[model samples]
Target: MEKQVEAIVEWLRQQLKQSGAKGFVVGVSGGIDSAVVANLIKRAAPENSLGVLLPIYTKPEHMTDSQKVIEKCGIDSLTLDLTESHNVMYSYIQDQLKGKNEFNESTDQLAGANLRARLRMSALYTVATNYNYLVVGTDNAAEWYTGYFTKYGDGGVDILPIVDFTKSEVRELAKYLDVPEEVITKAPSADLWEDQTDEKEMGTTYDRIDAYLGGEEIPEKDKDIIELLHKRSAHKRDPLPQYKRKS
Candidate 1:
C-alpha cells in the first residue's frame, strides 16, 4: 500500500510539473472514491490541491460527509450551491416537454440527476480554468469497467489517480490513510438522486462483481448479472477502432 501510494504521488507530481498545473481541483461528492482521491491529492501535493464541494439539491448527509472529508484532509475547499442551476435546468427541460410526457418519472428523475452531475463538472472546469488547476476525477476501475459514470459529466477530468484501483482496493487505501470510519463504511452512492444507491442501480454489489472479475466461482445468477453489465458497458471501456484508407 505504501509503495502504491508513493508511486501514485510521484506520477501525479511529474504530471503536474510537466503540464505546469498550478494546482488541482477535485469534485468532492462525499463518497469513498472522492474522499480517497482528495486524501491522495493532499498527500501528493499538499500545497497545490483544493477540494470543491458542489452540492446540487443534495441531501444533508452528503453535505455533512463533504465537510468531514475537508476537515479530515485539512485541504482547502469551498462549497458551491448548485440549487439555482439545477432549478433553471429543470424548468427549461420541463418547458421543452410542452405538456407532453416524453419520459416516465424514473427516466425524468435520472435525467435530472445526470444534469446535476454535468452542472457540477461545468463548475469544476470553470474553476480549473480560472485557477490554472487540473480537474481530478474520482472514478475507480470497477465503475469505469461498468460505465457507471455519466459521460462528459463526472467523466470529464484532466487526471484520474485512482482509476486503476478497484472499489475494494479503494477502501483498503482509505483505511491505510485513516479516512473517517463513517466515510469509509457509509453506503456507496452517487447521491445523484434521493434514495439512489449504486449497488442497487447496478443490480449487484461491488464485492460480487469484483469476485467474478477475479475469476472466483460466482453463482450463475450473479455471473449473469455481471456479464450483462459488462456487455452493456463495453463501449465505454474501449474506443472505436480506426481503419486505414487505401492511399
Candidate 2:
C-alpha cells in the first residue's frame, strides 16, 4: 500500500509538472471516493491542492464529515453553498415543464438532482479556472463502469486520478491515508438528495460491484443489473454522437 501511494503521488506530481498547472481543485462530497482523491492530491501538492465543498440542500452530517476530512488531512478548502442557486434552477425547470404535461415534480426529481451535480461542477471549474488548477473528479471504476454519475455533471472534470480503483480498493487506500473511520463506515451516499444512498439507488452494493469488477463470480441477477446499467449509460462514457462525414 505504501508503494502504491508513492507511485500515485509521483504520477500526480509528473502530470502537474508536464501540464504546468498551478494546482488541483477537487470537490469534496463527504463521500469516500472524493475524500480519498482529494487527500491524495493534497499529499502530492500540499501547497497547491484546494478541496472545495459544494453543498446544495445537503445534510448536516455530510458537512460534518467533510470538515473531518479537512481537519484530518490539513488540506486547504473553501465551501460554497449553492442551495439558493439550486432552488432557482429547479424551480425554473419545474415551471418550464409544468404546462407541457410531460413533466411533474415527482417524475422530474432526477432532473433537479442532476442539476445540483452540474451546479457543483460549474462551481469547481470556476474556482479551478481562477487559480489555473485542474478540476479533479472523485469517481471510481465501479461507478464509471455502471454510469452511476451524472453526465456533464459529476462526469465533467479535467482529470480523474483514481477512476481505475474499485470501492473496496478505495477503502483500503483511504485507510492507508488515515481517512476518518466514520467516513469509511458511513452508508455511501452522494448526498445529492434527501435519504438517498448509493446502494439503495443502484439496487446493489459495492461488495457486489467490486467482486464483479475484480473478475469474481456473482449472482446472475446482480450481473444482469450491472450489465443493464453499463449498456444504458454507454452514451455517458463516450463523446457526443455525430453523423459520419469525411474531413
lDDT (CA) per prediction: 0.86, 0.90
Q: Per-candidate RMSD vs. true structure? A: 2.1, 1.4
Which residue pairs collide, candidate 2?
none
The TM-score of predicted model 1 comes to 0.92
Q: Please identify model 2 stretches exceeding 4 Å from their true place.
A: 100-102
Candidate 1 whole-model C-alpha lDDT, 0 to 1: 0.86
Q: What are the clashing pairs of model 1? A: none
> 98-197 in candidate 1: lDDT tens per residue?
5676645657887888888899899999988988999999988778777888877898788889988888999999998878889999999988887989
The sequence of per-residue lDDT tens digits that candidate 2 reaches over residues 1-247 is 7887888888888889888998899988888988898888998999999989999989989999999998899899999999999998788777777768667667667878889999999999999889999888888999999999999898999888888889999999999999999999999987778899989999888899999998999999999999999999999998898999989
Q: What stretches of model 1 exceed 4 Å from their correct place? A: 99-106, 240-247
**Candidate 1 — number of clashing residue pairs?**
0
